[model samples]
Target chain A: MAEKRKIDARGSFCPGPLMELIAGIKAANVGDELEVLSTDRGSAADIPEWIKKVGHELLTTTEENGVWHITVRKTK
Target chain B: MKIVIVGGGMGGTILGNNLARRLHHELRTGKVRITMLSASDRHMYQPGLLYVAVGSMMPDELYRDQAGLLEPGIVFHVDPVENFMLDKRQVKTKSGAVHDYDVLVIATGSRAVMDSIPGLAENAETFYTEESAVRMLKRLRGFQGGRVVITVGVPHKCPMAPLEITFMLHDFFKERGIGDKVQLHYTYPIGRVHSLENVAKWAAPEFDRLGITYETLFNMKEVDGKTKTLTSEEGSSCKFDLLIAIPAHKGMEVVEKNGLGQNGWIPTNRTRLNMEGQENVFVLGDTTNLPISKAGSTAHFEAEALGENIAAMVKVGSPVRDYDGKVFCFIEAGKDRATYAMFNYTTPPDPKAPTRAVHWFKVAYNKLYWASARGLL
Candidate 1:
């Protein structure tokens, strides 16, 4: 099983959360799962698009308590 | 009634979206037709450029399709306006098409005139447009920990941007472990660091806390790009490793070409937002020579009153609404904290100290702004 890392980018703006997710993915091992929590609603839409563009596998996305949680898995 | 709006910038788009939604009935009945003329199809959320400069945001995220933001009843034209024939109530486009209008809204906004100061165009990095912001980001990433000077040119839009960059650079350098090696300086042409007295008072100590040298009333006269030095009109000189300047701004070229501007900016009635001596024409945002900060919040506030006034003008043939020159600015102190100031023509801004809550609000506002462009917020 791949290791899971969490990045709490809540209260951060657009691209803030996305940038944090990218940095987190860079530090994680291949096949590791990374989750980003963001309060900026645009992240829900932006992160998924970015993950697809970068050739990463998106696991799931959910919203709870006005915050969005986006999870991705590093494929390479 | 034909309403023609020039310049699909923040002010023009907001006014057009509001007016279109408010006049949907008249538009459906063919009693009103709205046309928007924009130089390009891109609508930029300018506030996001600050984050782009700091590498927190991407440049592509700051832009949206201009045509997508308008309602179905409005016509979006991607053509540069060549001339404004105000006397004949017509606007001429670069394609040689003349658009006649019963009501004209001029929101052409301002443009950065880097050539105003010698050597500035070749030397400094500005965070105003997407291309400029990307260039600034590249320059910032390659900085090697020396003096970074940020100057606020006179009558520049978003007066707080230089301050925000100052604070963000402090955090950025610290994060890079070069905070002790880098020195930050902020200079403005005004008598104080900020035009609002209370805001200046509140910011002075914060600048000191951040170890930023704040120089006021220092008007830029020349820049030597080869030597990497800047000279003030008073003969004072400063050397810098990198120059980040809020370049000199002026009203759009079409406005000046048509002789509709005084001192390079359109003069408007401060309260009515109408062009001087032209009752059927209106001006808003940075294009107006109003004694107010040319920030996005100013455009947002002006849109509120202008929308009401335009609605009344279309419905009853006269405007009854008045503007109070309200402006709100969220000042980012660092990556985690921000402060806000709210004021109007009669009241000076009493700025609060930095707080995490305001930072979150500013973050959320960036997302909410898209909804606002679609006339949903």
Candidate 2:
């Protein structure tokens, strides 16, 4: 079973959410799911860009009540 | 491992504190040591100088004791590096002490050199330093009002400073009841009002709405102090009543003297943040030849990457992460409104309309910076 990890980076700025996502991805096993909660609007677009560049699988990205939920699956 | 950090500005301080907290166990067990060498004992929140220029923040409020800001596991020294013997993995300080290190991190920040431009030092009002910010405040207070031209130079720190100062000046003069007399004319070296296309798109319309005229591709050439005239390399001139220049910046002189790089920028691997050709020597902040915006936020993000990597290297024999060239900067639009720009190496920024909420956040950040330096944020 692929475990899931959640990183809460709400109220943090741009790179904070990104850094937390990276840290979460590093700790997750390959094929595990990772979700990042970020309040930074910039990171909503950026985290997906990072996932694309790094060859990861982006699962879903949604926003509700000013918080962004960016999910990805570890590939390597 | 002896880790010697040269330069104790925003980048170095944040990196030092981050490592100290992460590698505390190794530090106490005598497996690792972190020492910071700096020019001064005081750390200045340099971004505050813009507010100081506009009389919102005092100079004293911008500084904290450098030693007090450090973590317990780190050793702090007020000795500036005089020579860099990179081959020997050692740095000699001004106090005649040579320290060798297993790892070296150079965070020697850049400086705004007014003298780099002919007649600019004597003729223009600037706010890059403490003395100059106060002087600019005085200059703004006594201005009788005319064509006040704000010219920007390349390689300067804080990408948004030139624009922010221009916006603040508009609000300042307007609050003083001289808004009609003050004609704010802004000039940029690039073809657009800003380098980033979206930021330029947003700012150009804002300038128009504020009745602030601007000229793009107006690269500053020389200022004739006697005639109060400013000339650009593009065969243009401005006869201005007052000239405010965001002067061209270069990394610290020590970096150039040691043959690290030309114009004081060390050749660095953009992702690894290591000085080119050296595995153990790293460079960050304004010292790197990275094409990213040289802002405090750049250093902060770089510090986080370095902290994670260095800690992993110490604990597990390898680094785990790479910097993604992340940078975030708040832009103050006039009348208590602000916007921000956030981007990395791969993605360009998309800025939006300014809002009062963002402006107040920036104001709050002015106080929050110290906690950030302490690695709490």
Candidate 3:
């Protein structure tokens, strides 16, 4: 039951947001949720795909204030 | 103050964004006008193009529209540059449009030369263009099994590209269960696999691990597609089923015609990226005569310093900013792992510096450096 971590990755190009999410996942414990904030349109699609492929759990994905906030939980 | 940057490649865009973010306030005083010119609507992440050609990344994923990445208040010119009037401080576009600038930056990058080898153009496929990358990717995917030769042409971008191709070929063959059938060979004009030792050391073991053949100090002279042979300058020959040739590099036609390129590249200071003769003009990225690999990371790092320098020059009319000739690269060796290197030409490292640390640092930089360039850091 740790506090969720947030990373701002707006204006970053591809592999940037995913890399930050991976880094964040690495620093968190199992069941820890992480939120990635990005402006890149591709991230909305790419992050969920990466999360599924890597065995991470997607918590929620929402767009607000001209940015997409993707939350993923460390599954393993 | 008016800032005009020509050529919307890696150098121009990075410098444009960096300047816009830093000098947004100065422009409110009517002291800054930054303009970027290029014909293409898409921003090609060129470094990933090589992987795209190898089927690692999809074509659409490697390219992004210029409109989305650019910031507000910066004018994007969707026209090709027809000519440059240096004395008049103007650039003429293809449609006869003229742009006047107080400070002009030339970031038109270099191009691959295919005419050097006679049969290369006819037989081999280059990964420079998106179309060519798609073609190469198709060829790689359909390749059943064959003797493939990967050779580095002279003065190519990302000097380690050929090595990376060879390493990935090994991985590709392994994954396809044809590792024993496809004989992979890597050839370089220089004795070392890479121009820099930081990358060459990691590549040496990977080559050994993957059992890829390598020939050094051999300059490729001709490719006889009929006979499936590659002839070298020393009159030696190697046979292959497929040829991946990295051709020689040449500056853009504009740089050559304007007398900017003397030794085949625009002469600029090693650190400042300022043109050797013109006071108002600056150049950076792979288009200059600096003794460094013409890679995106170099352009990215140089852009930060160059952009700041341009802003300072426009605001205070001074030239005081400095640049550290630092470049970081990540060599994807396949199998979900990479090798990275961070090289700084200033204060050459002692020969005793741990090569493994340099290698690991390079691997770790793959993610960190990519993020930093995207403005996430």
Candidate 4:
């Protein structure tokens, strides 16, 4: 809740944003929230599925000003 | 006078065959002799090894005896080379025998630079050599399940190999019912997934369907054996239980030691396979540091032009042909679906512009090229 992390993955293609998100989550502590900014259209759909399948907590996925922002939390 | 060619590779064998066929009258009259030096009696179809590794081609199909492939007038030397005496125009073998030549063709192709990367010697395995590819096939077959990472390292011979292996791994895992458990990661040093932009158009869609994570523009720096993670230049890393790596490739050390270049790759004119500064010494295939793809098809095209040029140089003392740097690579996209692209360097057509028809054209090309190279065409 206290620790918040952010990863900007704009201008990257598919799986690039997801990979950055995963790496960010791995380094973040449990209960820490990580936000990912991506420009790829696939990232908005891919990041949530990855978070759900891997047992991570997806706080929210939103699009603002032509960029998709995905927030995830380390569950375990 | 005798022409001695070292290494029975694409460049060497192709040059030897074309010369022997073209100069049949001279050879019959005993005016000239052609001798090809090779250590092993086997002649391998290097490109076929990729299909062989992925279970699409069998091992026996990729290999043929040296004698069976060479032209009749070309003599074969089944011995490793000791050294080349450039000034004396002769080559010495390990058996204390010296062979002289009027013209020398050092077509010794490259070997995999396996030791260039950290942990490759101890942790990672490669498909660079025929022997190693066979080992990799066995390693791929025995895998029940685990994290799979297919990486294309620096200075690799064929750039499309990692992508092919990635698709093959996807199919391999799906058939074994362990596709879900196996974490697949594809990595490359180029900006796009494929070096050519045209091919990337098709590749981008393929990766999307397979859910295969591809990391581009990341140079593989090192492998941590303790953690099983391969680190890249941009601080990105992937952990893998099974690591099949394509290491850096370098030309034969014999050429490198003679001051060809840093990695044994000689700088050659893109339009002609001839060495930049040296006369009478031409380089082709994976040996030369040409600004083209190191696929067999490119070599086949180069050999055709160089073969004619060599004939012209002998008869008229001038080259009549030049290499166009054209390359067409067939990318296997699993389940018999493939896509290919054709383009040339030094031109402004743009790269990676793949046509949907490239997929079928590539299949026909593979068959056509092999038959032609084997003299069946």
Predictions in order: lDDT = 0.81, 0.87, 0.73, 0.71
- The parts of candidate 1 lying over 4 Å away from their true place are A1-76
Ten consecutive residues with minimal summed lDDT in candidate 1 chain B? B188-197
> For this target, which candidate reaches the highest lDDT against the unseen true structure?
2
* Docking level of model 3: incorrect
Model 4 pairs whose backbones collide: B197-B351, B197-B352, B198-B351, B198-B352, B198-B353, B199-B352, B271-B323
Question: Mind giving the per-residue lDDT tens digits that candidate 1 earns over B4-117?
Answer: 998898888888989998899999999999999999999999999999988998888888999988888899999878988889999999989999999999888887888878
Candidate 4 Cα outliers beyond 4 Å, as residue runs: A1-76, B347-370
B299-320 per-residue lDDT for model 4 (tens digits): 7667777878877766777889
Better of 1 and 3 by TM-score: 1
Q: Cα deviation in Å at residue B61, candidate 4? A: 2.4
After best superposition, candidate 4 residue B193: deviation in angstroms? 0.7
Runs off by more than 4 Å, candidate 2: A1-76
DockQ-best of 2 and 3: 2
Instruction: Calculate DockQ per candidate and list them.
Output: 0.01, 0.02, 0.01, 0.02
* lDDT, model 1, position B327: 84
State, as a TM-score between 0 and 1, how close model 2 is to the true structure. 0.83
Pick out the ten consecutive residues of candidate 4 chain B with the lowest summed lDDT.
B346-355
At residue A76, candidate 3 shows an lDDT of 76
